[model samples]
Target: MLLEVKDLHASIGGKEILKGLSLTIKAGEVHAIMGPNGSGKSTLAQILAGREGYEVTAGSVRYNGVNLLDLEPEGRAQAGLFLGFQYPVEIPGVNNVYLLKAALNARQKAAGKPEIDAVSFMRLVKEKAALMEMDQSFLSRSVNEGFSGGEKKRNEIFQMAVLEPTLAILDETDSGLDIDALKVVANGVNLQRRDDRSVLLITHYQRLLDYIEPDYVHVLANGKIIHSGDKSLALQLEAEGYDALMAKAAG
Candidate 1:
């Protein structure tokens, strides 16, 4: 398994959020986690990304057979774990290409590899930027500064593509995107799919799935996965709504 989250129970500020949530992702699999607001979907992503503040009261997370909970956020990144934030932050005065090059070099250095040459790094970034359909001017701008919502989301995927993480956890990446931007972002994700890469897409709407097409679809409710099925499950949820599934799970 690329990522295994077993019976995860977490809380924030003394309030329970994740309750016995178990999930597994193998190499090359795309898993879509859909849920209503406050369902702990984002919480699960946060915990997996090694974000602090939320306490992991119980359960274990194994990534590539290692204890993921023991690693720091940067450690996780160096180990090929990437998280695409719902809201990408802006870093003023930091060049986007420069930041990405530094991040890539850091990961390579941690793996005992030599830093990439400037010429090769530029070529890589330009290729990835083209894959994301981003203009060349974006490379000169500050990271995510003055970008629109859709642009930020695209940049997140762009970073993921350049880094080539073994596992990616995207939290509500399609939250505020238009149809055109959504297609562009989804295409970028689809093009980056590799046999050694796994994706965990946390989303609320099935429309994103229409473009990306997950191998597995899971419905998370009240901090638990109440249902799991194939891509058709997303269509079912879209047609019938989460109410019926939530009621059935509760019953």
Candidate 2:
């Protein structure tokens, strides 16, 4: 198992958001989490990425057999864990490629590896940019400073591609994208999928699954996963909505 969350209970500002949530993701598997608003999907992703402001009240999260909750956010990133935020932040003066290079070097340094050379780094970035169908000029601009919603989301995936994280948690990456942009982002994700990488996609809609099919689809309700099935489950939820299946789970 790449990640294991057992009976996780977490809260923010004394209010519980994740209650008895459990999940496991093995290497190379893609899992999609779907739920209504306020179901704690993003909370789960945030906690896994070692975000602050959320307290773990009970239970445990183990990543690659390590006590994941004990690691700091930067530690988690260096350990090959990546989180793509629902809203990508804008850094006004930091060049996009510069940030990615620094991040990559940091991770490499943590692993006792040499920093990637300039030539190799540029080659890799350009290759990934082409994969995301991004203009080369965008790489030189400040990170997400003036990017559209779709462009920001695609840039997050582009960062994921370059970093080549072992486990990626994408929180609503497909939320505001049009069909064309969605396909571009999905394609970028698909091309990066490998036997050594795992992806956890938190989404509210089923349309994303149409492009990047997951091995498992999980329904989260009231802070816990109420049900799980294959890709067909997403189609079911799309067709019938959450009420019917959630009702069945309640029974």
Each model's lDDT: 0.95, 0.95
Least lDDT summed over 10 consecutive residues: which range in candidate 2?
Answer: 43-52
lDDT of 2 by residue, 1-251 (tens): 99999999999999999999999999999999999999999999999998889999999999999999999998999999999999999999999999999999999999999999999999999999999999999999999999999999999999999999999999999999999999999999999999999999999999999999999999999899999999999999999999998899899
What's the CA RMSD of model 1 in angstroms? 0.7
How close is every model to the real structure, measured as TM-score? 0.99, 0.98
Residue pairs whose backbone atoms clash in candidate 2? none
Off by over 4 Å in 1: none
lDDT of 2 at 216: 100
How far in Å is the alpha carbon of 34 misplaced in model 1? Answer: 0.3
